[model samples]
Target: MGISPLNCGWGICVFLSLCLISFTPPCDGGNILVYPVDGSHWINMKVLIEELHARGHNITVIRASTSLYIKEKSPLYKSITIELDKKVEPFFIQYLQKHIKAQVEGASAFTFFKITLGFVSAFSQLHLLMCDYLAQTLDDPTMVKSLRDSQFDLVLTDPAIAPGVILAKYLELPLVFNVRWITGGEGHFAIAPSPLSYIPVPRSGLTDKMNFIERVRNVFFYSIALLQQRLIGPHYDAICEKYIEGGCDIISLLQEADIWLFRSDFVFDFPRPTMPNIVYIGGFQCKPAQPLPVELEDFVQGAGEHGVIIMTLGTLVYDLPKEVSDAIASVFAKMPQKVIWRYKGKRPSTLGNNTLLVDWMPQKDLLGHPLTKVFVAHGGTNGVQEAIYYGVPVLGIPLFFDQYDNLLRLQQRGAGKILHLSEISQCFEQSLMEVLHQDSYRQNMQRLSDLHRDQPVAPMDQAVFWVEYVMRHKGAAHLRTEAYKMPWYSYYCLDVVLLLLAAVTLLLLSTVTMFRFLCYRCLRKPKAKQH
Candidate 1:
């Protein structure tokens, strides 16, 4: 039964067509997975998710809370817990492990630390998960496996969660890390000051002895860390080898990424590394105005020419001490212009006629209004970006975390002033007066604001363009750096052992030459005596 040549060729073509159909990803509904660090919906994830959904992508949101859903109801919200175990689907584990192995060897030391810290910060994440009221909706292993098997097109993630990132890698999905603040750049600490110029020298400059003590303290602490790493390093090494080949190569992930969207203005000193993948998409989410709420509009209009000042301490740090509140109230009472505060807790008893305290306010909308003069803030990145967007100068009362760093940049840029927690009374009042009365701060802020707004494309659009570029290019390996593959010593060019050997050889030769010259001179003296 000999098959005819023409019939065989046609059969092969039909077989290949079916194979292509089976392998191709479904275009009818592309999944866009959102992986927020627990309860981090407020950290620009909400807006991004909404935007992605609006663009007609089928979204499967893997978040850590119901608090996010409480304010905004959407069909896309998938209440899945992020905890991964053997109970998870076998296929997902296989995909994730395989995917991570390919990328792990090229990760940077910094990336390694960030991914490890994600594991260490589990307590913090759990706390947020509990606080945000999302403990019950965790995704079971099977569901996660099923989703991975389905093969999503893109993963929008926060790098603080290594597991989510690893999952993205396993699924071969295009990923984007949402860096909420300007924490990666030098001097721009997430929760503290950088160890660069600002060595923990006290502000008074009277503690020379303390600096020595601090140095010794740091050495001892680092020694302890080394000792611990030595003890557990082998175990971790073994585990990583067993699971993710080459373990945690975070640097490779950073370099291989399509683009890094920094939500920071140029005023933020983003330690400019020579990398093309980094993009300053500083105020992507900040949109220009819609008219203010009717009551708020009338209130601003009624203020006549004195205008308005807005005071807010963002979401997490809203719990200001009563004394601090009293001090702020006292200062605001003295100002001629009207003040509107988004004080979340109890309203103060001593409210003046010109002041209004509300549980919440449309912060960006208020800042965008023409009558708003100054901002008193906790110096959160979003607030800082908004203030910069609106060209309104700030009086930063930085309490804790990266607030201090953000405040410092604003002060250095001449766009704002910083008032420490202890010196808030004198500093805050004085700074507020200067910002309002003097025109330089406002003018400088406006100049910077204009530069930020004048960019070629809006930040969010640029972000979307890059995301699509990654998918189109099938991971964009052209953007990845070769530097990531080099060993630490090779990268630093430390051939010190070879240099030491060369120095020893030269010293020995020089000594032998000197000895020979002296002997010859002595022998010549003897010959002269004999003559």
Candidate 2:
């Protein structure tokens, strides 16, 4: 009676509970700072941020006012907006508008140097604004104090913004890159093994499969891109020095990054050698198809059998030349399926009864809908990824930047067809019809979608896991490749090649000398016998 059965059971339960609690891992909540380059980059970071915050990480985003639009406000994160010079935003926008118009007219017509220089000029101007912002942030005592107090564990940055790289160096934090494009320019290639023979230069419009001449052209374009980066380097260096104490260069900062999350997947991209630190978190931004707004739901549902076609040029391309719009409308009018076109500019007068124009549309939701037959897009990376995610075949009218390369990959995958802006008026109808009617395009798209979803963990979860893993381990130095530290000649084993060449030459010369000596000895012995 001294020890009761009930007391013994309670004691056993308490012991088990204590043991479980002792074995459980502690939550490693970290302060993460995100430095996004532009609105597109911010959009791409949304899902990753959401997941990290959900897992109890504190996120702080530093963005320009012009580019700071967070659709979902969360208590788990804070946003710091920096106001730029009034003239800066307008100039950047105007320059981009002009460039887009020129591209629409004919990007292929422009010389390679001209295009490369144009991009350099645009990036340089943008970087100058970023530098000004960084200088202001550093000069402001309150801002500097706050950043220091936060004590961020890691910095997530976009390499496109040189100042962001400088800021990471200033904070002395481990850097992790979030590249929104297929390739992250020279900074990415510096860390990863990017063979020019296979990996096409960004914006070069060359595919991975290149012939001898194409390979030479690819190399030439890549050289120009590298030259463009070098030309812009000194300016970036100057900006860094003006802002931070003992400022470091962009290349050095990038090379020191712990990890790089590329928004490109091998399913959509060609196979290439990647280091352990180079993580492919493509489609991480894509969420499940949410319910469309009532009106959109009704419209898509109304297209019962024929289905609907969604056309969007993404957020940047707000203004399309009248001719291009008219040609698109004309093609949509001819098609039997209903069309929903997202046009921010003037409503096209040629819009038919079967078409509806809106200033914005839920592109991902629309693409995921079963009744959506085909997507006519500008081949932006996000749009391509969405189309691939939803298994929607695309008819890409690539205009500029990485659009051409994205479309080229789509075409190679047989999930899409490409129509140049110049050819849109003539080929748009046929391309649209082919993508809609052809069974192969849909089949291939479905296969791609399957491959994209075939991973063990969801893309967003994988991203969050790796991020927390970095924080847990302090830094992922083991994952980083030694290639980044090696010189070009050393990385490629050129020294070994030279040594082999020297050995072969010495052997050849020794053999020739020995043969001549043998001949002379034989002749001299015959002369001696005659004497």
Report the error of model 1 at residue 149, Å: 2.6
Instruction: TM-score for candidate 2, please give it.
Output: 0.87
In order, the Cα lDDT scores of the candidates are: 0.61, 0.79
RMSD vs true structure, all candidates: 14.0, 4.8
- Per-residue alpha-carbon lDDT of candidate 1 for residues 1-531, written as tens digits (9 for 90 to 100): 999999999999999999987552423334677666533224576676666666666767664323323233367555454433222123223333332332224455475455434432433333233322321222345665677675777777765433444456546677666664311222122222224222322111111133665666544443533343343334323323434545653334443445555566565543433346655677777898779889988888877788999999766544455656777888888877889998876666556778888888889899998999999998877888888888999988764345766777678778898876667645667878998878889998897788778986788877766665665565665664576567757755666766888999999999999999998988885434553
lDDT of 2 by residue, 172-209 (tens): 77877887431236344766678888888777778778
Off by over 4 Å in 1: 1-30, 38-41, 65-141, 180-246, 249-256, 496-531
Clash counts per candidate, in order, are 12, 0
Model 2 weakest lDDT span, ten residues long: 180-189
What are the runs in model 2 whose C-alpha is more than 4 Å off? 1-26, 68-76, 86-92, 103-116, 180-188, 239-248, 499-531
TM-score of each: 0.71, 0.87
Superposition error at 115 for model 1 (Å): 24
